[model samples]
Every structure is written in C-alpha cells, then in structure tokens.
Target: MNGKQKQSYKYDKHKQRLFIIPARITSNVNNDILVIDRIYDDDDGRVVVLDREGQVKWTYQGNPQVNSGDKLFNPTDIVITSVGHVIVSDVNNHALHVLSGEGDVLTCKVMEDQGIIFPMSLDIDTKGQLWVGCHSGDDQRKDAKLHVIKMSF
Candidate 1:
C-alpha cells in the first residue's frame, strides 16, 4: 500500500421493485428512497418508498384517507420534507397534494396554472422546497418546463 492514505468511497447497489416510474429518485433524511410509480397521460401517478436497506416500507398511495370519488387519480412523484411530511405531485387531477404521515390530505392545490401540466417527478432541496418536473405531452415534450413549488409547511 502507498504511504499516502487512500480515501475510499463506495455505494451499495441494493435494488427493490416498488414503483413503476423509476426515472426519478429522492432520499429522505433517514435515507429512505421515494420513487415515482408511473407516468400517466393526464396527471401525476404514484410514489413508493424504500428503506435504507432497499426494503419496501410502506407506500403513500395518494392520501389513503381521501375517499375515492370515482374520478380521482394517484400521485406521480413524492418528496419527504424535513418535517416528515409527504409531498406528492397528483398529476391526473392537475394538482399537488400534501399528506400527513398517516396518508391524510393536508392540503391540495392546482399546479396547472403554474405551467404544471403533468407532474412526473419531484425533488426536495436542503431548505425543504419542492422541485417539480412537468410533462406537457409527447407533442410538446421538447418544450416541457420544470416547476419549482415552495412548500409552506
């Protein structure tokens, strides 16, 4: 071995099949990973969570407390805030949904007016702000824009 100390870095390649849309990924403070479930035509889809060891914890399926009205869609991408709140991009309905730990809708708002057509992915910064990636359909995909929605809670 060289006299100089070798600073080594390594990453674990633990794979777990949880969500459909595996294009984007985010990690919580606890190293829990959140991935997009799938991409839909009209709205956001679902987000799945995986523990540090690459084990499925529990998925937040679009606010489990909200009663389905027969015209509701699931979440596309999810973000776990520093405060432990789950933020989801509810695409089909053209909105962003915030849920509590137990999967209850804490707040919901239409992100379409903000040029958010179909939110497909989400990312959270150190300051706890949400970065949203929207898809305006394949025809306009080349012009798709990224929306940054600042979380209040």
Candidate 2:
C-alpha cells in the first residue's frame, strides 16, 4: 500500500456489522475522536465521540431544547473548542450546536436572523474566535458571507 495500511472497525457495540458514514472528523485535546455520522435514511444525523482505543464514548443526535420542532438533519462540520466542547454546524437546521465534552447538549442556536444562510464549516482561532463559513441560500450565491463570533469558552 502506498499509505499506511489502516484497519477497519465498527463503532456500534450492539450491531457487529452496522455501517457508519463518517463525513467529518476531529480529535479533542484528550485524543478522543469526534465523528459526524451522516446516515441518509430514516435516522437523523448524529455525532459520535470515541475514545483513543476506538471505543464509543458518547453519541449526540441533536439538542431537543434548541431543536424543539426539528431533528438534526445534516451536520456538515465539527470543531472542538478549547474547553473541550464540540461545536457542530447543523446545516439543514440552520443552527449551531454546542455539546459538552461528555456529549451533553450545552446550547443550540438557529442564526437565521443573524444572516446565516447555510453554515457549512467552522474553526476556532488561537484568540478564541469562531469563524464560520456559509453557503449562500440565495440562487445567485451573492449572499454568502463569513461570520466571526468571539467565543468565551
């Protein structure tokens, strides 16, 4: 093999052959693997956190408190904050989800009023600022803009 041979393994502890579509991935300061499970079926999108040993630590489907009327349709990207919180860009929901290190839903906000068309990606800088890139919801693609928000933690 040109690259290092990588072994394949399943994440689901119950189902031996359950398939997982990992769209985006990142590692926390603790070396935990955070993955965005993008299954295109009856099931909604979810975020799976795994330990260094490939063991499933916790899974976050969506934040009910923020998404009271909808499910986590499509999570495009994820970034772990300095405090170990996982921030996800909920594309279809038009929202940003903040999850605690242990997979608890800390907060969720739909930023439609803030001119967020379709947030597709995000990252945190050394100064603790969040930069969000969005796809234009308008047909002409003229509404696309980058959003910068100062993050405390």
- Which pairs clash (backbone N, Cα, C closer than 3 Å) in model 1? 21-37, 43-91, 43-92, 44-91, 44-92, 45-75, 45-76, 46-75
Q: Which window of ten consecutive residues has the lowest lDDT sum in model 1? A: 7-16
Clashes of 2: 0
Q: Pick the candidate with the highest lDDT.
A: 2
Cα-based lDDT for every prediction: 0.65, 0.80
Q: lDDT value for candidate 2? A: 0.80
Q: What is the overall TM-score of model 1 with all chains considered together?
A: 0.59
Q: Over the stretch 1-153, how does candidate 2's per-residue lDDT look in tens digits?
A: 679756555745675533468888899999888888877763367888878667788888777755446554568899999889999998767889888899887788898888885888999998889999998867676877899989764
Worst 10 residues of 2 by lDDT: 11-20
Candidate 1 per-residue C-alpha lDDT over 8-109 given as tens digits, one digit per residue, 9 for 90 to 100: 212224543444456457777676676665544334355666666666666655643341564355566677777777777776666777866544668877
Stretches > 4 Å off in candidate 1: 1-60, 63-72
